[model samples]
Target: MGIQEIAQATGLSKATVSRALRGLPTVAGSTVDQVRRVADELGYVPSSAAAGLATGRQRAVGVVLPVIDRWFTAKALGGVDAELRAAGYDLVLYNLGGPGGDRHRAFRRAMLRQRVDALVLLSLVLDETERRELQVSELPTVVIGGPAHDLRNVGVDDHEVAALAVAHLTGLGHREVAYVGGEDEAGFTVAVPYLRRDGFTEAMARAGAPVRADRYADGRFSFAGGVAAGAVLLEVPAPDRPTAVVCASDEMALGVVVAAHRLGLEVPRDVSVTGVDGHEYGEVLGLTTVAQDPEAQGRVAARTVVLEAQGASPGPLPPSAARLVVRRTTAGPCR
Candidate 1:
């Protein structure tokens, strides 16, 4: 059985029956129910390939990511999946596989193919070649976690997120502070870490606690990286050491806590620590942090791209929100 038989039985045109079967918004609810009932009664199974050929839409969205294993990436992917599931759209994920992955080939071979109707890029700053390729493809695109040169993005104001963390620490009267952050090891020049680092510097300066030259260490945005950087910042003479530390991620903050423990320092007594991104481990470890919702950002990006792909004009998206979540890791400097 097919759409033709269903159409004949329902006394509707084949076009209307097809649209109804595809669940196009233009079809009325009652008409959709009628068409579906007829199709089911006739034991009709709709072919996705036939539908795609008929409508010139693949009914799928592509999500391109620099990596797949990070906490932010996983959460955001879940959000995109949830929104796409609701919209009856499929998700096609393209993982770059970290550093040395053939991004050029991936862009040319996988994305340029007519597989997905829209695209969502996660935290990638496209190069000129990549940008031109995207333009050539003419796919409706949305970015999450970082701003692309000319594309719409859905993520928190990273600078402001860092400033919130800085303000929280400074308000507690901590003057000497160290910073832990770094770029992606996969060699993608992500903007989030740079923005957060700049925000930390500016906020500290504004609070009259200008960061010292030696107080900065690259945490590499990983727990192990954080441990290495944390030791460099904390294993110092008492007067020379920073009284508080601010990390770009909760994973790094947790690493700092571990490094502190290894060095026989008591948190909030010998030194205080804070982080960004409300990682679950942060709660377990009682780490103060400024939290932003990556999952919500993902949902927004998916929804926006899907709408644009469907020929809907959406307005510029406002930046996502971030706020301070204080816990036991921060305190006033020791007297």
Candidate 2:
């Protein structure tokens, strides 16, 4: 019913019940649990508006993303949602439609209605104008899958991930390696595609298996794009074709596998294929990859913002883990 009823049931003062309900750090853990049990027994429903009036916090977190349909974005979003829900915080999602979505309107300072206590951004590089607007809000902010300029980030190190993938291929004695990555799409501010590509190039150079200019093709970070890029790279003469191919995403890697089948090229024997991202389909397809957990990244981002919102100064986050998963698609070059 209300804090007053809960306080009576628990024999605790209304002030203690209120503090426990808000989950303030100053409240003792055992007392907080006792208050919650009594409150639940009394069917008490905490009101967000009342909480906001008391604490000047909206009890909500805003999540901003460029799109919603992709595998990584969706998974990360789920993770963020779960964490926020567990913390008794509402999620306010702000989808920017897609690559061509209205940038000016979304980042306008007036668009933020002061309805959220904090913000979690997913892999978007903000320009100067957008940055200023966020600064004006001054909400505790963190980015998932992105390490943009001076923003707290929660994701794998793109450079380290790329190098790990490349090292795996080169260790298998594959010298002629090709790369499949995309450019930042028009109206999109993602830095991952280029970061992975450059990391791949630099890793190859370090391994003494430098990639040729013609050996690289833009996969556009999609299945169709991967298929097209794979075809161009694999359709060449045997001697001229790369013995290994590294894709920036699992969707693209799966596409390359399809392209290989169509071109009558045997994986590992003809060309070893690798990818980044541990997409759900990757396991079924048996594709080797540098797997990083987007869902986990999302959870970390949400937790960090929630803590910061609660007046806790969390330290800098270490990069999320990324490890290579060797599967049937890659083996020592048999060519």
Candidate 3:
């Protein structure tokens, strides 16, 4: 059986029949369901090459993200893959290497060749030229983890996430708290680390806690970075050491805890620690943290772009939520 035969029998256009049978949202849901029923009854099958030529639509989605090996990125990809597959779309991934890896090459050279129907950008920062190129391409796009001009974005408020971590520590009567974070200013996409840092500083001031000069440290958002920052902060004599430390990410929080033990200090008893991200390790390490689900963010971003690619109009997308989780790594400061 063929599309024309199905269209003639159903009293629909061949174009409509072709689109509906393929599960493209360009057709109305009821019409699609009916078409599928007819196709099934007749045992009609679609030819892959003909369908592409007829619809001019690739059943594919492009995903751009950084650091594919990271837990957050992997989980986000998992969510994206599931959603796109359920919607009958394939995912084409582009991994931009870490800082200094020349991500612009993906935009300058590779992206145009892929001819994907839509794009989802996860935690990637675009410069002026790249942003202009993206706009000119006029592809259906969804942004995750941060903003892109006039595009739908899904993410947690970084400021609020950091504030949650600080509030948790301050509420426990810790007067001195430090922050371990990434390089918010250079070689990064958006100002996530900077926004979180600001949140911590503002929250501390509101709680009547002073962040001393020595209380701040900078490092990447990794276990090793956390360990380095942790050592710097905890190696101080007890009189000057912070009672609790807030980290920009959960991975860093775990590092700080290990640093505490190595320096002969007990968690919570000597130095309380908190971080952002509801990372998988948080439960195992008992690290208190402000939690946001990256997978859920990925799901939201994927759904948004896929629907838009299928011809649904774009609209407002509110940021995802973040909350605090208390665990064994934090307690009131030991006097």
Q: In candidate 2, what are the lDDT values of residues 144-188, reduced to their tens digit?
A: 886778888898889999999999999989899999988645333
RMSD to true structure for each model, in Å: 10.4, 11.2, 11.1
Candidate 2 C-alpha error for residue 26, in Å: 36
C-alpha positional error of residue 180 in candidate 3 after TM-score superposition, expressed in Å: 0.6
Report clash pairs, candidate 2: none
Per-residue lDDT of 273 in model 2: 95
Residue 240 in candidate 3, Cα distance off native in Å: 0.9
Of models 1 and 3, which has the larger TM-score?
1
Candidate maximizing TM-score: 1
lDDT of 1: 0.85
What root-mean-square deviation over C-alphas does model 3 reach? 11.1
Ranking by lDDT: 1, 2, 3
Error of 1 at 155 (Å): 0.7
Q: List the pairs of residues colliding in candidate 1.
A: none
